[model samples]
Target: QMQGALEQHLARLNELLASRGDYVQTLKFTQQLAGSIVLQLQGLPAWRGVSADLTELSGQVAYVEYYRWLAYLLFFILVLTVCLLACLGLAKHSRCLLLLMLCCGLLMLVLSWASMAVDTAAAVGTSDFCVAPDKFIMNQTDDEISAEVVHYYLYCDQSLSSPFQQALTVFQRSLTTMQIQMQGLIQYALPLFPTAEKDLLGVQQLLNSSETGLHQLTALLDCRGLHKDYLDGLIGICYDGVEGLLYLGLFSLLAA
Candidate 1:
């Protein structure tokens, strides 16, 4: 009877342990389900929103960074070109050519200034450059029409801001002046030769004449005084051929 009671007690203990294990498993399952629900509810939307926000911000930064790189590349190219030109000028020992280049640069600067004054963002900055193969740089400003009476300065050159108006204007005045100067030059001076051909028998004679002309040209380029005289002579003589060049010179002087 004692042994049978001990066996019965042991069986009861085993049953209780099994019941506690079941209870603990059920509680763990509930806890796991609750944790899963809370995690999905909290993390899914939060992660999605965070991911989208990060992508949007990253795209903006990338776009701005691209523009900055493009701007830097363009700046480098411009500097490289200038350096090459300087090297070429120095190697050739052509001071007169250098002066002419300087004059042209000044003229360009003036035109750029005029455009900028009329519109704040005229020569698009390096950062603003685009990769379009064909570009149209048209003067399209709404205020340009109403800007008629404004007297603006293109560097040192004073000009009417508007391309219209019957009033005193710088560009129109330049045209009139150039025409007058041309009329005087064509009145005198040699008709320009068509070609510089040479005969086999008279090679030395041709060479001697060429050498003399080259020497005179070199002497004329020795100083600014002579250079200016040659340039003034050119204004009256090469009018039809180099009208653009003359205005460029005038613009340069005005700018300087």
Candidate 2:
């Protein structure tokens, strides 16, 4: 029975790790898409502000990656230290080493409890994020893009796929139609209303700037921002991280 339980726990651990790997891959893809969007639009004055947000997100992703590996290293070292102390105490029958090992084990127990508390809070926060991710996504949006429109992009699963594709198509056609209308205005209306030239010029600049935003819009319309953040938080806090904390808790109990 003990062996069976151990096997089951190990299997669950493997499954969690595999799921975490998938989340990491998704995060990498999201980072790439965000970088591309930022690169494409940041040259335009319209995109300057959002570009900073994207940069900050990318930096956060890098930090996540860094801290993940760092945690792995620390956990490995913790386990190694315990095993070494146990072996030394067993082979030499040293009371001093056993006392030191007990002291270290007690410290680990305290740390594990603290870590578990933090992880639990993080899991709760992530649960909240996953529940209403659209609100978070909308917060990152620029003034020019409506929150509803941005929501469509991040949540574009199978049901939404067709509608967004059609929206893009319609947007493109509208641009073409506006170009035709502008040509007519320049040719005929400008002759009688020379004063309208300034307004026309303003419209032209707006259209050009809109094109830059459109490029970004099409990219952001995919699952790159909020969805990624929610998934990352979900897996990082609730699954792999929490599982590791549980294992540490188990180890501390056993050591004590």
Candidate that would win on lDDT: 2
Highest TM-score against the true fold, candidate: 2
Candidate-wise lDDT, in order = 0.38, 0.58
Evaluated against the true structure, the overall lDDT of model 1 is 0.38
RMSD of 2: 23.0
Looking at model 1, residue 10 earns an lDDT score of 31
Estimate the overall C-alpha local distance difference test score of candidate 2: 0.58
lDDT of 2 at 32: 43
TM-score of each: 0.25, 0.48
Q: Tell me the tens digit of each residue's lDDT in model 2 across 140-202.
A: 584755655565556646455533465555555555454455555556555755655665444
| Residue range 1-256, candidate 1, lDDT tens digits | 3223323433433343344454334324433433343343333112344346658977996897598458546534544554566677788988975776566565556654553342233223221322221121112221331222111111112232322222213223432443333233223211221121111112223224434643554343233453355346444334432444344334434443
